[model samples]
Target: MNAIEVENLRKEFKSYSSRSGLVGAFRDLFTRNYKIIRAVNDISFTVKQGEMVGYIGENGAGKSTTIKMLTGILTPTSGKVIVNGMNPHKEREAFVRTIGVVFGQRSQLWWDIAVQESFRLLKKVYRVSDKDYNEHMNHVIETLDIGPLLDKPVRKLSLGQRMRCELAAALIHNPPLLFLDEPTIGLDVLVKLKIRQFLKEINEKYNTTILLTTHDISDIEALCERVIMLDEGKIIYDGSLQKLKETWGEGKQIQFTFVSEMSLDTLKELTDGLQVTWKQGEQANVWTAHAPSALLPEVISRVVNRYSIQDLNINEISTEEIIRNIYEEGVVHG
Candidate 1:
């Protein structure tokens, strides 16, 4: 059975048009001047058990709206949202026990309490027995390396420390499904790496079904194999991450260094057949093109044989580049 299922799920909000002045502002309160904004339109997808899927989109593209609806924070304006065979909003209390959620920008922990206190509260909220809670809590603490921050109040802890606590808090219940939204938003590199590694281990060990929503492409690349891309509240693409690359990411960003000097004319000649778009530099050229990494060896061979090639480096097309092109050009072209 699917772990989560959404059928033509949609969410609409009102963009209220306010008046300019005090009198107008007061009058506008009663005036129904607004436009219907479809934050999520015809969004539908299913996640299999133990699958780590990336739910990605730019800001205001309804990624958060879709997650809100899924987690029962907001009732959908229309359509169905079912998680683990139950309605998330209608069966909130029970439904929550089956899932764990961490919103990086928002804290579920109480500000006045110590980080450990927040975990205790979650344990109580979930009615976790002492033995089960202790087992899971200890495991999470070790996995996330949050033992040091346990006594610090939620407000006093650094952003990274608190985020670690937040992650531990979410997993205290040992929920089978997890939702992480920008979990590495402001973390430093080391922290992000640790978090990524911990998450990968948890997923592999427990078969935790995770839906990660992140603008950080590295998170998607490291954690997810499938992606459900959103555009203006619509499902723009949904498939294997590899296929997304093959379909619209058949481009390489190449950097070339010359033993001597080389001009754009020389670059043009060397990469004549390659669909190249030069970015910058002359003696050292950085260019982007609709050529995959597979084409790099030949390009390198050709340039080396003709020009005084000193050094050459090829970067595979990034997830950001592919998604950016999809958003900007409004189409995914090969």
Candidate 2:
């Protein structure tokens, strides 16, 4: 069975149309004039068991709204969201037992309590067995290096430390599915690397299904094989990371090192009318442009023959460039 099945899911929020004043607030209580904002439009997608999927979009793209609905924090305005074959909203108490959720900017751990105290409370709440809880706690604490931090109050820990603790709290029960929203936000490079490694180990060792939502593209690139992109509350793209690139990205950035430095105008003149973009460096002249793979040879030849080329190489397009190209040009919608 699919880990998640969202069929034509949607969520709408109501906003009042009133002036900014106490009188407006009092009038709104009597009249109740409000406008509907479709935070999530008709969106449908399925996530297979153990699949690592990236749910990404720019601000105001309904990414959070969709996740909230699936987690049962907010009921959908229409359609269905079934997680692990059960309606998340209707079966919330039972469904939460099978999943873990983390939001980078928020903390699930109690502020005034020591970190391990929170863990103990979680054990009781989840009704974890002594054997499983101890073993899992050891693995989580050791893997994340939170042993030293277990005694510290959550309010005393740094953002990065708190985040690590939060992750451990989520995994303490060994839930089959993990929902992470911006898990790496505000973390330093080293901290982010640690989180990524931890996630990889869990997926490989236990086959934990992860649904990650993040504005950080690197998180998506590192953790997700499949991505579902949303635009204005609509599903724009859904497929493997490579497929998204192949369909929208013009692969390969060819770099040329000439015998001598060439100005942009000179380079453009050499490869005229071919949509070639060029740049010059201290040691070598550089050119970055988009060219289809099929016509790459002819495109290369046109430049190589015209200029006194020293050396050249081609590189794969970056994930950032690919996504940017999509948003700039591809008007994908539900």
Candidate 3:
């Protein structure tokens, strides 16, 4: 069964076209002009049960808007949104119970309450049984390492501490679906790593369906196998992450440090017919080459056999680079 089913879903908002200057300001006081903005254009997609899908796009690209619709926070202007076999907006109370949402910039925990107190409140709100709550809470606290944070007030905890608690709060009900919006935002590498690891473990252990929306490319790369890329409120690309990489990520930047200084002409002759382009570095012994990924083995083998290399560095196409290419140049190459 599909965890999420959205068909031609769209959201629109109105923005005031306020004019400048004294006369315009006086006119605007009496009358205001509005322009319609389609935050989410007609788009359609589905996520299978227990699947982890990345919903990615730049700011104002309707990522949050779509999430709002799915979570029943906002009503869609048109089209259909069904999450976990029920209409989110229509069946809000029951729908919310089946899903856990974490917004990185927002807090679901009460500001003045202790983290443990907040968890209890959530358990009460969700009506989780004592046995079930105890089991889940123990696992969550241990896995997220939030035992030290349980007694502290939500506002007193550090951002990382609070975020860890946030995950615990969301999972208190043991919901089948999880919606994460930049859960790792503003976190240091260590915190991000912990969050990613926790997410992976829960998804695997419980078969939880996850819809992760993030600008942190590493988060998507680490947790998601498929991505639904949005641009200007449109679904630009939706498919396997590996396929996206292979299709747009063939170029590689390889750097080599030779044992001895090699002249540019000698370097050129050595790499001839290898479909590689040479770029000189500041130091004569160090050189860089841009080549297709397919030719990496041939380039490395040829250079390794012929020359004594001190060091070699290979830089693969980053997820950011791939997405940037799709944005700058449309998905289809002519």
- Computed on alpha carbons, the lDDT of every model, listed in order, comes to 0.85, 0.86, 0.91
Model 1, 35-64: lDDT tens per residue? 999999987789999999999998998988
For model 2, residues 1-334, the per-residue Cα lDDT tens digits are 6999998988888997776699988887779777899989999999988999999988899998888888889988899888987898888789989999998888899999999999999998889999999887898899999999999999999999999999999998899999999998999999999999999999988899999999888988899999999988998989899887777666567778777666777766766766544544455465565666665787788877877777788877788877876777766833
Candidate 3 lDDT, 156-240, residue by residue in tens:
9989999999888999999999999989889999999999999999999999999999999999999999999998889988999
Ranked by lDDT from best down, the candidates are: 3, 2, 1
Candidate 1 deviates by what RMSD? 3.6
What's the CA RMSD for each of the models?
Answer: 3.6, 4.2, 4.7
Best by TM-score: 1
TM per candidate comes to 0.85, 0.84, 0.84
Question: Model 1's lDDT to the true fold?
Answer: 0.85
Q: Is candidate 1 or candidate 3 better by TM-score?
A: 1
Q: List the residue pairs that clash in candidate 3.
A: none
**Between which residue pairs do clashes occur in model 2?**
none
- TM-score-superior candidate, 1 or 2: 1
